[model samples]
Every structure is written in C-alpha cells, then in structure tokens.
Target: MTPIGFVHSTRTDATDDAWDAEATTIHLDGDTFSPEALQGLDAFSHAVIVYWFDRVPPEKITTGARHPRGNESWPKVGIFAQRGKNRPNRIGVTTVRIVDVQNLSVTVEGLDAIDRTPVLDIKPYMLEFAPRGTVSQPQWSKELMSDYWRTIQSQ
Candidate 1:
C-alpha cells in the first residue's frame, strides 16, 4: 500500500523509548490527500496513526520466539506476544493526542515513529473501539513499557 503521508519529527534514531515527549507533524501529500480529508478530525482529542517501520531491515523480521527487546530478563515469547518492531509486517500503530490540524498537515503528540517514517493511515479515536473486557498482561510486558511513554522525569 502507498503511504498517504510522512512524519516530521526531531527524532531520527530509535535508541530512545520515551515517545510521549515527541511532537510530530504528519505531512500529508496534498496531491493525493487533499486538505479536505482532515475535515472534523480536530473534533477528536486523539487519533490512531498507522505507519511503516521503514528503518527495520528485512533480516530483523522474526516469526519465532525470542526475548523481548533481546533482554534475557524477560521470558522468551512468541513474536505475537511482544510489541517489538521486528515483526513479520513492519507496521507500527500508536494512539496520539491531536495537537493541531492544519492544511495538509496534522500535528500530533506521542507518535513513536521517527522522522520521515511513512504514514499509512489515520483513524479517529473512539471510545467504542476500546477493549470491552478487563485488559491483562504479564509483569514483563509492564516492565517493558514502563519507560516507553515519556514521564515527567524524561521530559
């Protein structure tokens, strides 16, 4: 699928995990997606951005079990069990707060993608789409994401 837009952010490297501090601009191709496409988007407080992990090499794709982030402290688990970037399909999705919606561009916060990352699509955040039942995950998963979103200390 073709990317409808690309991200513009200060982050170029993937070493940092605190994404919440990142303020990104999704520059849509006006030739493809007109400014009218963003109508009513500003009404939403947040959105779900679907983007490509273009930086991830094909050799990094994993279908088998492995430690999350290669950290032995976390138990070895199937690729589906972890949110690692090295997936069969290098697709990344993140819910971000909408900072602004301008012509041919959307400014967002907390998008984990780096600068120049191809953005596939944007979906408005709907409460109905949230998990209906109690959400549960392993302690390791919690530890893995503890520092993912930027905390006051990280900023």
Candidate 2:
C-alpha cells in the first residue's frame, strides 16, 4: 500500500525508549490529498497513527518467541505477544497527542516514529475506541513498559 504522508522530525535513529520526547510533524502529500482532508482533525486531542517500519531489515524479522530487549529476566514471549518491531508485518501503530493540525500537516507529540517514516493513515482518537473491560498483563510486561511512555523534562 502507498503512504498517505511522511513524518518530519529531528529524530533519525530509533532508540528503545524515550519516544515521548520526540515531536514530529506528519506532512500529508499535497499532490495526493487536499487541505480538506485534515480540516476537522484539530478538534481532536489525540490521533492514532498507522505507519510502516521502513527501517527494519528483512533478516531482523522474526516469528519465534524471544525475550523482550534480550533481557533474560523477562520470559520468552511470542512475536505477537509483544510490541517489538521484528514482527512479520512490520507495521507500527501509535496513539499520540495532537499538538497542532494545519491544512496538510499535523504536529504531534510523543509519536514513536522517526523522520521520513511512511505514514499509512491517521485517525482521530476517541474515548469510545478505548478498551471497554479490564486490561490484564504480566508483571514482566509492566516492567518492560515502565518507561516506554515517559517524557523527558527540561532542566
């Protein structure tokens, strides 16, 4: 599938953590879409972004179970059980704060994507889309994600 837009950010390398400090702008292809596409997006507080993992190499893709971050303390889990980028589909989805939405560009805070990442789609986040029932997970998963969404505060 083709990309609807591309990310613009100072972040060039993909790190394991500290994504909440990254602020990026998603510039929709003006030639393919018009300003009306994002007209009502500003009304939303957040957006769910679907992007392609263009940087992950083919050999890195795995289907078997492995420890998260290669930490032996964490139990081995299947690819689908975790949010690693080594999955088969190589697709990434993230919910980010909508900082500003212009005609064809959307500035978002805390997007876990790098510059030039191919954005497949963007949808405004709604409260109704959240989980309805209780959410359960192992202690290891919680520890693994303890700092995944922490923002870097200025000194």
- Report per-prediction Cα RMSD to one decimal: 1.3, 1.3
139 in model 2: Cα distance from truth in Å?
1.2
- Writing each residue's lDDT as its tens digit, candidate 1 over 26-102 gives 99988888889999999999999999999999998999999988899989999888877888998989999999999
lDDT assessment of candidate 2: 0.91
With candidate 2 superimposed using the best TM-score fit, by how many Å does residue 119's alpha carbon deviate from the native?
0.2
| Native-to-model Cα distance after best TM-score fit, residue 154 in candidate 2, in Å | 7.0
User: How many residue pairs clash in model 2?
Assistant: 0
| Per-residue lDDT of 6 in model 1 | 99
CA lDDT scores, all candidates in order:
0.91, 0.91
What is the alpha-carbon lDDT for the whole of candidate 1?
A: 0.91
Residue-by-residue lDDT tens digits, candidate 2, 1-155: 99999999878988877787777999999999999999999999999999998999999998999999999999999999998887898999999999998889999988888899999999999999999999999999999888887767831
